[model samples]
Target: MNYNTENLDDKRLVALYKKMLLPRLIEEKMLILLRQGKISKWFSGIGQEAIAVGVTMALNDDEYILPMHRNLGIFTTRNIPLNRLFSQWQGKASGFTKGRDRSFHFGSQEHKIVGMISHLGPQLGVADGIALASKLKHKNQVTAVFTGEGGTSEGDFHEALNVASVWQLPVLFCIENNGYGLSTPTKEQYNCEHLADRAVGYGMEAHIIDGNNIIEVYTKVQELAESIRNNPRPVLIEFKTFRMRGHEESSGTDYVPKALFETWETKDPIANFEQFLLTENILSADNIEEIKIKYTKNINDNLELSFNESKIESSEIKELNDVFNIIENEIITHSSEEKEFRFIDAISEGLKQCMERHDDLIIMGQDIAEYGGVFKITEGFLEQFGKERIRNTPICESAIIEVAMGLSIAGMKSVVEMQFADFISSGFNPVVNLLAKSYYRWGQQADVVIRMPCGGGVGAGPFHSQTNEAWFTKTPGLKVVYPAFPYDAKGLLASAVNDPNPVLFFEHKGLYRSIREDVPTDYYTLPLGKASVLKDGTEITVISYGMGLHWVLETLKQYPEISVDVIDLRTLQPLDTETMFNSVKKTGKAIILQEDSLFGSLSSEISALIMENCFEYLDAPVKRVGSLDTPIPFAKALEDQYLGESRFEAALKSLLAY
Candidate 1:
């Protein structure tokens, strides 16, 4: 095909050739290493180099690009150090993630590279966050996210695209329409004629280009990128490409038809581009040989040098005390003012104070803007903070949660309000896998506080009335806070927002308007992983949090003769073991209580901790008090029986008699 080269200069063409050539050479060496059992696995981008190179070359140095596992050209194009890149592939301690995450499932904040999460769709939302940050910062920088044709079927992809289009975010969704998603053909993937056609439903501009044509990709993408930077709207570009290899080296290409490979082999990006360079007289055939020889040697040398770096010998446990340093800009009002507040009001006051202090802090969720949340937590936030800071998103819990992680990548903080604690299940993957594991896996701090309105009493039933703090408490790298009183709620929330890790802040919906205390109107931070002794006694130590603590205190008032040490575990993740242990040691008897069901509840873990740490001091076997092991019922009568006063009274008698 005769090409248009009036706008493509010679110097730029050679630079593009080198970028594309380097990855080609690197992959060639690495695949050899894979077969030799040197590198454990390889996800080769042998055929799809043009897309990564073209998209990366067009972006500004500071602009972020989230690339998939197959997009090796991106790392090479961005000049990521070959030694470390090789080290990462080899799982060495010197690698980007220091052997914490496997393969290219790692992000490099230094190089403006947000690598793909193994689950392909979530990164699209992350790209939205980076682009939103650019828009908020008024940088006008574009963020380009890459995905295959199969990834387009993911809910996150659709959610992210809708959000980007709705907000007109400067994001370029690059869909490399590779023929198959693993062994499954595109025929089974989507019914659409073209993947780019899906973008029209999202109200975004769509473009289709020949993926094997390097000149077409570079020139066209550069134009679209420049256009988005100027106008600041999303554009999805479908690069019609083919993956020449199987999903990975282990998976053979037997499923692929012979005709497809023959067709794609003729349109090989490197062969065609090299022919174009040769035909244009841009460089001699000797120059092409020299470029390949130079990088091929460089790739071998880097691979050899990287082998000298030791693999991760021993796995290190994540440090719980590695707290995020919150740089306070403005001091809170000095006046000593304490006012009566309900649990809901304290949360509102605390968030308001935090927003006032941190100008860049954003709060995102569904209907959180005009509706002020179902419980009215963010009643006037949209008006006070404006639309940008207080964002109302589509029903995209999975993507929006990672969107907070993306904000953290851009050095911003966010609070994601899950309408109900049960709804958090929708956004659970990013919390457990992506956001929660980020710091441990890659030293990337995702400073996000997820507001969870939890617990049962008002008969909201199985979905809304869940005491699910136990779900996150066991997950490493996440802080869980459940404050019983308004004072603790306000103070703990401030600390949660300021903390450098992801925190699950549980608020009992029953306690929201019912529980009242004198909470300070001024900003204050209650340190997490610290316990407060509400009452000191000698007979027994009862460690509890949230509604369970309230039940303990109330029940204790009725049992006047049975003096007990009442402890409120303000934070669930970093259990204040010191306080709980000392109390149990002093009292010589213990009981762990929680509103969750008995089996696999946080109460059982506390019982284990007491038995392990203070077994000798125990006057009797450590007792656990929890709600009945059954799903929260809808009927008020059944719920009352399930969480009845008799259940706790009986447990107290059994422990006391022992």
Candidate 2:
């Protein structure tokens, strides 16, 4: 169906035409910069301006927008300073991320615009979480998320739509069907007829529209945004358009067919809108030319201003020290009496206390609501905090993690639970790529803790029983915490909740009920990177964490004569080098133990550290002990053999003899 410009009032028609022209001109200028080598890269929204500008203009000023990399028109429509946009492209300190990120990789909290990631699909789930927050607060605001036709095929796209539909969230999923995903056409990308048809499977409202028509995009998006704001439901609108240029400046359009490219050139949204304005007499040709000249001048002036902005100073390039934002000296809670608390209860209590203390704290996991989680770690939380705070999400790990990142960006402290640490592989992309990089790149506080029930020994086998702390330990900008006792579990969890960076809190399932400790009755916090010397010895030093620490302690009972100094590395990322080095320096011998595979494990990292720091002090070569190099066995006998006390006993004897 053709969208008539006559349907819009004169003022609205003029405004839409100008909005379409502004970004087109800016992109044209950016192309010149790209050729001149003034800009590093450019992703143009040349022919698809109407879709981004129309939807952005239709939404309320306070409403949130999650724009993809190509949605440059959103920046113009939202009035993001053109100079700042240019500064980001130029990698100047004046940019939103202080020269840390380029392109649409940086978000503006002041403008209520969340930036996009290259992965593209994860942000859709994050937008769902933002919409969920708005709905819970009764803000009557709608979050509009932009993605391409290719993004619809992603697993996260399916996860986001399913959750939004299940919860009836206030979300506007604006998909720009630009005919191609980078270089592949829609026919080769998906089997579906229209991308909008896939939304029906999720029980979401779906529509298809002529993306070149400004009036159609604006009117339809405006009406749908209003409906979702009032009714709180997700609607998917697919705008059919084409990208006139290649994916980026460096990626040439040699892959495109000549006839197809020529066809889209005539259908340029800006030119089509301009022609409509002139034919309808809503805007005179001279007046439209003046608008074009004005925008051209505006773009050039902003480019000059951005070039003048100061470069990032060397002094400003500080280390990533805020990985764990902890309050050191403050006694959060003081009590003389101690109560015996189980490890699982301590974890639940830490979450409860954090939620009660901070109104912004939220918990999300599968079966966490009425079912209280598969392991009952969140039992009775649904009744206490209500469903709004304790959300039971679908078993989509990527979506769950991405949603948590969104909540964190919105200044909410989120705690996500993985039923088994092994399942973290499903959510690995968002955690390692987005959550770990947020703080270092843009200084955004990823105030989130992913509770991972890890370690083997349970008959659950490989898929469920596994220690994955080593994966995160190797990653920068993330803190890895594993507490062997209930005291550390409760205190460290409280600290993880308060930390401004993302934390992976590993809780060994075997230690959940097998051990108990005298936990402080009142709320308190422990330092994230601090290590506790559980036992002091002069002969040998054994460094371990989680269930591995427990095995070390138990193994020492058989050898009563061995004075082994057992150190629990509560936090793995910032390994307590001082404590471990000092112990090894005193003992002149070291042993590392982990529940992960022996090769390339956390023990390997610790052994390397020992070699580097205490080479001269060591009387013998350091030893490492861990599970066998294979997937956890399903059979009880093989599993025990794979992870048994004999392994630690043998390693300790070898180290002692050496």
Candidate 3:
């Protein structure tokens, strides 16, 4: 059990011991704060401090780090202020997120930390992405990502590891095998005896270490970190450690047996290291006492100072707005005479133009390069823009999105395509945790565009036919754009490509080849939050988007007497409320229509917005027309029944009658 620290100086050994002690003390302090009602509940990183500190110390300062929630030791050793961490626990203004995030959600770009994304194994893909970028940019920096053993089962982990191994990315995939994930142990989570063994399947070099032993953990990590930096190849390291506390501050320890607790307590990494230092004559008892007193005094003084600091003012609402700063006056100008173009062609041209204007923009997806994408919209792009700019990605949706997020964070504008909108669920974590919440959590901007071919009318069945715009619309800090026409498609897509935030660009599969109008060959940009009034009428206001707009237009042609004012909600998140309310107030009636299911769709939100703003002006109650609450059937007759053009007409007629 006696591990030699002969290679390390006395000062270095003491430093390693100090690093392990910080998280232990911080965890104890956090528990006390939680009990006293000063801080909110959170997971404690008590027994696993050795692994966190040792692995972090192995990496260079310029390298990137993506830590999970149970990475307090890593954050503490990296010199994150104790008071700011405390403020985060308290959900106070002085916290890293300024009260917008939970405790343990730490991120700091200044320290080369890419932030902790909480959705389990997805961080591995993100780490690979950062490493890929570092390689592409020729930066001598590796990306180290930490996760739990439970994360290994996710498809994202396998996909990312495979890609990293194939591409030889400079990444260190560290799994904190802390025996348990919430209530389930590793045996219950994975079938393999050792999690590190799984890495071999992906062609990655795997390592297994005693995570409780600081010396062993540090030595193994140092060797791997050097190999990764020298060869720039991805490696997976599984650190077998134990959780000294429950999963989180709110978790009950009843599930853990008393005997197991006593056993782990005796093998406490912090106490064991202290004893080892004393027995080896590296540190006397007096030195141990002096080190503890110094750290305690430092933590206590910083905590008191942070607590005494004045809280953020309520009137400073503008501070939150400062997080998103749009570079104004960069708008591109276009001629008033708009020429017609097909929706697919417009989308293709928009991306080509964006890539030409901004060198940082890169496009990738299934069949995007040689095949020019599934729809052939990207035809000739690979030739014109080179393979680097218009690259083809494997059929890995999760890895594709994770790469886009990482590239965006590294100052590249990435346009990632999900072959079909329905498959977006595979990459939901990157879109939600990293893309949508990047600016809000870590103060980092993600200028990434996710182009998905959505909507159903071609009988593609449930798998290929879907409108998941509602999913992204429901999440804040993201822009969702569904253009109805070719001009809007070109303009809106151009705008989205240039915007500083993450955008979900939904290109209706039905509209892509079916619709065409006069779109200008020259470059143009449209305002993202603005909606266009297609046909102005006074009888009733119809709010619709994407393929639903076509249905409404056709219905208007059939019923000339209805005299409807149609408003196209081009952008869903920053909804054109002014135009929407004005149209409703002028008509005194509104109808919201979409192709998505009626339950919790964007149509419901449109109805609520109308009712909230134009309730008094309404001549009748607002109505919504959408697909029935059922899956899109494979049969033509069933599909028609589920989603019909007549349904929109009926809703409009009902609104007009009222």
Candidate 4:
């Protein structure tokens, strides 16, 4: 430890010692609770307390700290009330997540501490977004993220560091190399001696510190933090320490050699740092003992209070609806003097309007910069918004979505473009597991718009042409929007940008240039979850969206005698049941059409919905039309046959005949 006692004043030294002491005491008490079967799981940073506490001390009060499960000590330094922390673990109503999570899975928004993703690596990218936000706002605050040695193996770690380095965002990547990632030793995890060595690959400043020495950890972090806040760049610091306990209380120590465990036990961060304070004459033995007693009493009292609080009942949990808060702006209809726009042009114009309205709206995706997007949806965006708001990201899907979630946490709305909807399969984890569950779990909503260019007919094989809306429609928290006209695309996208929850806005490849409408030159937002009736008739009702709506319209044109009523369900999720049921009840027959595969299709869901609500009004059985179960073939003939208009016409005829 290069830090001298004279460098830190007596008061600062004492504060540092106490900060490290609280987490250690809390960890010891948590183990006791674990044995009594009071807590569900326990992951302690016993010997790594210095890393969490020291970094917390170094960061500015307003700076964000994204902490992993093991870094619970940071909550103490952040001054998050002890009762709230205990209440979370105790599954009580007053916890950050209102008893939704059973462990250290919640973050304090007031304290600028974001809750961690269980898969710790994603938080690194999230921190990158936080840092990006600070830089964008020109705020003098850096973001510090914590992770374990084992976490480096995850791909997001590399992705985050690369993005941070490329942008020169002020981010501090703290890796607590505590010998093992769960049971796997450091030697088995990576070939490098120090995790900091990997930082060079990402063009980040690297530092290695003795994590057991509190003074060393704090002094080094403080020095790096000062530089980061001023110059704004990422710095990776590896804190070498050991975990005193096995992965959890029950994991057993047999996997770790007894001698190895004993050696680290002697070098325990809390006791070692406490002895150093006494040696330096910074604290008396009585003072050190009093501090421990004071914190222990505080923790125990909180534990009691948390246990006495009411558990979150099912009804109470249900009160936290899918989306937390909807920032519903008044609808400003497009005036009569509006201009006509192509579907793709309307999308770009809508985003431009959003960016013009809110400074916090950011656009991110691959090739979305000076090169514009491959489809040129973001053409001229770079010149209009500049690079800070318009980011050209690497082809890393999961990290792109995760980083957007982080920006949303920092009070910014992000619009992420997936080059093709099929490519979203590469980033399914964050979208389905994290992004979808965020609001329901902790009342945190990431105001993000994922723009997916989807559907077949352009002859861009299976990967490029896909209608994946059904996947998100099945998910609980997501809102799926697919517009068939330019006006709907522009208006719905405006609504999606203003929407407080995550929205999957699907733009069909076929309709990008082919569809045109008199879109309002002025800003206008269409109501989400409200179906638009394109035509009204009496014989049969056709329900469709995206490119399929065009097919339904064309098929209706050929059969003018059939008297078909057409409904465009602009939003798949939160589907407009009233309009759909009313139309079906009037016609007494329904034909559901979609571009996705027939098995488990969106049409299948609507079929079930119709049977459940409008069965009595039906004069004929409902029919569904869609592509074959096979993957979208590259051959134009086969692809045309797969989604041929004849198939759609046949389904409509069959339903009408029955």
Give all TM-scores, in the order shown: 0.97, 0.96, 0.92, 0.97
Model 3: lDDT equals 0.83
lDDT accuracy of residue 320 in candidate 3: 47
Pairs of colliding residues, candidate 2: none
What is residue 272's positional error in candidate 2, in angstroms?
A: 1.8
Model 2 bad stretches (over 4 Å): 1-8, 310-317, 322-331
Q: Which tens-of-lDDT digit does each residue in 1-658 have in candidate 1? A: 3456777789998898888999988888888889999889988888899899989998888999999999999988889999999999888877887676777888888888988778888899989888888899989789999999999999889989988898899999999998889888999999999999998899989999998778888889889888888899999999999988889989989999899899899998888888888988988999988887888888878887898876576533333333323234232332478899999999998999889988989999889999998989899998999999999988888878878888889999999999889988888888888787777677788889999999898988899898898889878778899999999999888888888789899999989999999877788888888899999899998888898888888888889998889999999977899999999999998888788888998888888988999988889998887778898998989888787344777788789898
Candidate 2 lDDT score relative to the true structure: 0.86
Give the clash total for candidate 3.
7
The reply for model 3, stretches above 4 Å from the true place, is: 2-7, 249-267, 279-281, 310-329, 335-340, 558-563, 650-654
lDDT of 3 by residue, 1-658 (tens): 4566768888888899999997887778778878988776868788888888998888887777888887787788788888887777666777887777786665687677766666777777778777877877788677898888888878888888887887788888889898888989777999888998988788888889888889898888888887777788988889888887789878877788789889888777889989988998989999888988888888888789778877655445665464454566256878777656789989988888988888878898888998999999889998998877787887788888888878876777889988999998988888887788878776778888999898888999999999899898888778899999999999899999898898999999999888989888889899898999999899888889999889988878888877778999899977889999999899999888888998998888888988998899998998889998998988888889999565887777667776
* Per-residue lDDT of candidate 2, residues 1-658 (tens digit): 2556556678887888788788888888888878889988888888899898899889999998999988888888889999988998887877877677799998888888988878989899889888877887789989999899888889989998998899898888989999888888888999988989988788888999889878889998888888878789999999999998898867778888999999988888888777766777778889978888888889989999998888766453354553434345344764887888889888888889888988988899989999998889899999999998999989899988988888886677889999888899999999998898877666676888999998888888879998888889888888899999999999888888887789999999998888988888888988878999988989999999888888888888888898878999999977889999999999999988888888878888889989999999999999988888999998989999898456888778988998
Clashing pairs in 4: none
For each candidate, the alpha-carbon lDDT, in order, equals 0.87, 0.86, 0.83, 0.86
Better of 1 and 4 by lDDT: 1
Worst 10 residues of 3 by lDDT: 320-329
TM-score of candidate 2 to 2 decimals = 0.96
- Give the Å shift of residue 277 in candidate 2: 1.9
Candidate 3: give the clashing pairs: 339-518, 339-519, 340-517, 340-518, 340-519, 341-517, 341-519
lDDT of 4 by residue, 478-510 (tens): 889999999999899999999888899999989
